[model samples]
Target: MIWKEILIRYGELSTKGRNKKDFINRLRANIRHLFSDIAPLEIVSERDRMHIKIENDEQYEVLMKKLPTVFGIQSFSPVAVCSKELDDMKKLSLIIMEQFKEQEITFKVEVRRSDKTFPLESHEIQREIGGHVLRNNPNISVQVKKPDVELRIEVRQDAIYMMAQIIQGAGGMPVGSNGKSLLMLSGGIDSPVAGYLLMKRGVRLEAIHFFSPPYTSDNSLEKVKVLANELTKFGANIRLHVIPFTEIQVLIKDRVPSNTIMTTTRRMMMRIADKLREEIGALGIVTGESLGQVASQTLESLTAINDVSNTPILRPLIAFDKLEIIDIAEQIGTYETSIQPFEDCCTIFTPANPKTKPKVEKVTYYESFTEFDELIERAVRNREVYKFPEVNQVKDKFEGLL
Candidate 1:
């Protein structure tokens, strides 16, 4: 056969004290779920690593797309399987090298013979394979330290495997290992990045987005939906809860002074998110609030927001600078979409001078203007839930809660 199998290297899963099997099993299921539509495969969870064997060669393209996004996978390689003989390995090494382009290649061969009695030691196998690769590909040279390609050869009881290139993965614990959280998703850059970082830490996420219609068009809501969909590529099944925020915004603006409007609005959003978090059994709530990024994100403003939600608030970008957060946003494919000029609830009706040092008591005073208990209940009742991959289309009931 031409393409033999895929080898998966585990990250933190390898260091677990007593729960390593649990992590491996979770990772196996994750990989299988990601690959289910793409291929029929068998997963072999070994002592320290995992192997994925595909049913047909046609699934290679699908694997290339899906494998890199599976969390907990440190790296993966498409390896060629050979017989447990040095000559068989040498022959396959050349074939692996043929896949390398005409550009100058500096190479090294690393051999791990797990079967102690197979005759040739690791170094001996490396030497024989390295020499043959040098002779056959005249333009290619060897670099003992950090070569262009580190060709790997592994000898085990069943077969000999060789591969040249390694693909890096998402590299966190598998999703679903950590308890669920509610991501306070926005059309802006930071929240999407926050969701990504949490997912990387194995926290399964259901996202909540605040949409103010007319003040915020359907276009604005759709932008956040697209952002959540992009996150699915990283292996998260996100549900974007689009909450009608127009009436809440108008209520705060009409009853409160401009300076406290932003803080009060944030507190309302937090209250609604907290209620939803409990309903969904989420352990905490996540937000995009960076320290002092906006008036409503100031230390005092944050305190005002936190006062409303008993659930733990997870601000993944709390300490990050804007550029640092943007860099991650760009890397995770959410940067361009976040920078789009569609206003979500947070941006519209922003007061010129929101309270930077808002007190819990002052925020509470203005919150009394509108008896918001009924409004919050209504917002939650009318919330539209868009579970990604399946709910690709945001329904026509976009004008609800108006």
Candidate 2:
């Protein structure tokens, strides 16, 4: 490949004034972590844009495939480095344009002369290079407004770079720049989609999954693990905390009134999640509770759940329709796995006639009969923690006897 560097443009990060450097540093760190398994790289972060110098075609190919998945990048270009000489610029421009040789292409030349001391002005360089390409290639025509192909040239202090394509990036602030949160991940379609949206907004995540054995099978737990692993593709590795919730779930089912059981159960989950959030130093709790999608997601039910904790409850898909949530789940590659036939704790014990407008006072009175504080503490203590995108310890166990 002729391109020697990948130019990255920061999208929302550019709007940050004094904190710009912090965001940029965080982005650079994320890029480094994302590409750690690949060859060593020289990632240069600048005031306006960042560049990853391409060492070979292999590195370029890998970068092109993976870079778009990273947040904070608005767009990127594969740039061909050239000398300051006009002849060198012209020759390289023709070489770059050869990709569109046979087709009739509307093209324009854009030049950014960062090195003001360069002899030619920005327009001068554009004209010189543009004139060269038109003279040589008969199929290429110049169009100023939204050209089909734009040959962008940047005359920087060290070297001049040129490219024809600007690929769109996953635009947002860098992950972890906003802060950290604990995602109340469930073995369902909506929770994974909720996690994706939060990560897109630069919130780092550690997931909490409730598990109830016998009531919920191992397959159900595996499904949640798969979802958490799938989510790691968007940003950094996620630590999935699996809480042993069988005792608490059973107590709620036996003690609470049948109609208001869902509300009480959800409140218990909130209390446990909030406790874990505090333990892990998370700022808030994230859930996939879309408004009115289920009995537990109604305004009254959400308010009842909210009363368990003072910490913020972030419901990213609160207003989204079911179809809208599914579309995002499909886009992020979690739909197929999430649709697997597995019964999670929430679904396994779903009430026959759950109260849509459950009274908080009534649910509170019913839950007061059960001693839940000790069970909640024990569940959090016996939780299983696994880091995603890494080999799970349970999966690595030797089953056959030696």
Q: Number of the top candidate by lDDT? A: 2
RMSD of each: 3.3, 3.2
TM-score of 2: 0.94
In order, the Cα lDDT scores of the candidates are: 0.85, 0.90
Q: Model 2, poorest ten-residue lDDT window?
A: 393-402
Could you give candidate 2's per-residue lDDT for residues 222-280 as a string of tens digits?
A: 88888898888876899999999999988888998888878888899999999999999
Candidate 2, clashing residue pairs?
Answer: none
Please give the lDDT score at residue 195 for candidate 2: 90
The local lDDT score (0 to 100) that residue 331 gets in candidate 2 is: 85
Quote each prediction's TM-score: 0.94, 0.94
Measured on C-alpha atoms, candidate 2 has an lDDT of 0.90
Off by over 4 Å in 1: 391-402
